[model samples]
Target: MKNHFKIYISFLILFGLTSCSKLLEEVPKSQVNKDQFYQNEAQCIAGLNGCYDNLTDIFTHNLFKINEGSSDLAFWALDDADASFAISPANPGVGDIIWTAAYHGVMVCNATIVGINKSPVAEGRKKSLVAEAVTLRALYYYVLTSMFGDVPFYTKEVANFDDLEEITKLGRMPASDTRNYLIKDLAEYAPALPQIKTSLIVGNRVSASLAYILIAKMAMWEKKYDVALPALQKIMGIYGSLQSYKLVDILFRNKNIEESILEVQFAWSATGIRKTTLVAAITTPPRTANTSIYDGVEILELGDKANPSTSITPSDHLIDIFNKYPNDIREKIVMARDYNDKWFNRPSRDNFEGKPWMGPKFWAIQMDNKLDGNNQKVFRYADALLMAAECYNEIGNEAEALRYINMTKIRANIPILEVYPGKQSFFEELMDERGRELMGEYGRKWDLVRWGIFYDSINNTIATENEKIKANLRPYHEFYPIPDEEVFRSKGVLTNDAYKQ
Candidate 1:
């Protein structure tokens, strides 16, 4: 999609109707008759664009809160009381918002797919558009199944109120079935997507390489190293190298670089509300009182009344890890001691009060702090390399694994490792490296969960924060509870036994 593209009014009108109710709810037959609306290429593309809009909605501050805050790397600063252990179904925190947003995306994709299939658009265009919709649907389901163990699955779009009974009566699909479905969908449709995006007009759209990466990621989550390797290898051949970490301007400022596989596009010029993202406002810290340290440097304005800064500070553990690799440029780029300056070490308790270490990865240079146009990086080449390294290590190819790991390290101007103690040790190093490299980008909680370390890691290292967090670290906490609203809406069909009464 073009950075400056306007969301079509037709799409807004259609999707607006569906968003008001559950994922399975139907629009009035007179309001948006899919048979009448999706007659030509423009309408079908608009329907696809509606599907893309769901992604923008999903990648918001709420998503960041649930994904990262639930992990050990960060915690919700605003609602620490209820948010510390937001894993419970009983406590409807950001997870419910995430659940609703993801399913909404799925619903839109389903509608788009159904509409495109019926449209009289040319066979090639119809197939490609439907493929895109299918891929997007799979992505939403992938996220849903990853977060909420089993989720209500649907392929058909709701056409009328009568369809609600059938849709609502459906139950959650097992996570294994969900993964297999995603793998199959991606594999089938990925080839239809362009291998490389040739222009900025289509830059943020998913590509074949991205689909492969997603496939590999799903396989990795299931510990199917063999299944993930070929896809990762395919990605390596297509996007061969990582963007140099030394080129700070190209690294963060420029969107859709050689390093970027998939990013949520945002531009100040894009039409519609929130054309820009609030990541800058959410991640940036409020300026400290002592501004004399950087005499003339201007601090990026923090929380405005309209869009207040979220004050999401990095954990002290993350700070210490970065300090271990002081020479690494990634450490400098991702976090800071003061505004726009690299954090070398943890400051004394008193010195660290207002100046909590904050992630600068998404902080754009623009002075308008509220409306940031910085594109959020969803997938990057570096993540692919790390994933490939992990796959190789799992399969006992330590040499190949280290080669990929060292390649990433070399780009950061850090020393390459010549040895690893064992596979477990290498995996530990990888976990740390991923935390350092992709800290503010989100994905840590899922990573820890897939690694089967969520409980131990949080209880051992992170639970010291409070008794509430410690008490909430049960086995079932690995999978978030389905939102109570969703269960209530499902009536007897949906259940939330995982949550404590």
Candidate 2:
């Protein structure tokens, strides 16, 4: 069956109907019906390109919104008054789009690898491409697992309905299991990925440090400090240094020239990415402002046009978490209230008349907001060291933990505060730094979930805000409720219902 598989065997490879596999692998990328499309090197690369599109979609689409929001920074921010306690099933199918897009990415990676193997290209180049695909697919699963826990773990694209059902119902692998899968994938692929020039920004599309970030996340979840150490050690030794802090850059716009690890690709475009522009993820400098742009603010507005893609703002609790940063970078990160021209440009200059400006970690746009401006970073070195610090703390290596913590601080030019600052627990201090540094970059909710602080924070926010409806903000929200739609197809095998809410 493996030898007989041919992605280019048919003419309808575009429909994602079948896969090409060697050695009877169960998951290839989305079933690319073997067709003429798989016959050439260009076709193989195109398929890989499509897979890369899935990653951008995740950030620009639904998961990035909810996953970040419901975690710590926000309540659902829904127009519906009933959303305060959004029950098991929520949303009107946007999550479905995310689900489709995520699997679609995985499928592309699977198919690309299979097609590469079948190609006539040299094995070395082919292997390099294969490494990138695996690293990307692994990252895709990491996102999928973060959003909808226990996603079907398909490594090869299944062309047959039987195989689809079998794989789909395979149930949620323990979170640990899915994490291990990605960890292994990154470890295998990271070395093969090239050392990318920061400005050039695209290589085989994955880097060694990026892999360490993923492994650091996996180890953090598994509480495997030792297992996670070598990866961070690799990162620290090679690519994990933090960019020196510039006060103006740190306060007004947050981007670490040095710390960035993985970044979703974006080109400066006048028109803008429909997803990012609407969601406020993209920013421009003043000279290049584009007004017709429906900036994320217009999209995030409450009345009728709230964006489905906005990177939700930090909650009051998140604001309080950084209360210690009175003059520190985090307070200046975003406007406590709406701010206009005089302040937006020099936000670090002790401002007033504030509205919700983008958080400091993310640079707000230029005079006229457009998508072509700021770049979104996926992995940064500070996160790696912080992750290492967490693992070190858990393993009771206080010295190692302090080293990583101080390293991130020294880069930010933050004062070298104790890991256990007076009255602040070590874990509390760590969580605070995570909020202050990574705030809106997409890891807050995960940190809250892993730290088991959602209930305390969300409930407190609701009480503080006098929010109309009350949500349990339970552990289930920690991992989005696996879409009810996926559950229906699982034949009772894969269900979020089984996990005690």
Q: Rate the local accuracy (lDDT) of all candidates.
A: 0.68, 0.57
* Poorest stretch of ten by lDDT in candidate 2: 299-308
Please write out the lDDT profile of model 1 over residues 226-315, one tens digit for every residue.
Answer: 888888887777766674433363333467666677777777643553567676766655433434121123443432222336556666
Considering every candidate listed, which one attains the maximal TM-score?
1
TM-score of each: 0.85, 0.77
> Which segments of model 2 are wrong by more than 4 Å?
1-44, 75-77, 80-87, 90-94, 196-204, 243-258, 267-277, 281-313, 336-357, 360-374, 418-424, 469-472, 498-501
Estimate the lDDT of model 2: 0.57
RMSD of each: 4.7, 7.0
**Residue pairs with backbone atoms closer than 3 Å in model 1 (clashes):** 303-309
Residue 348 of model 1 has an lDDT of 22
Model number with the top lDDT: 1
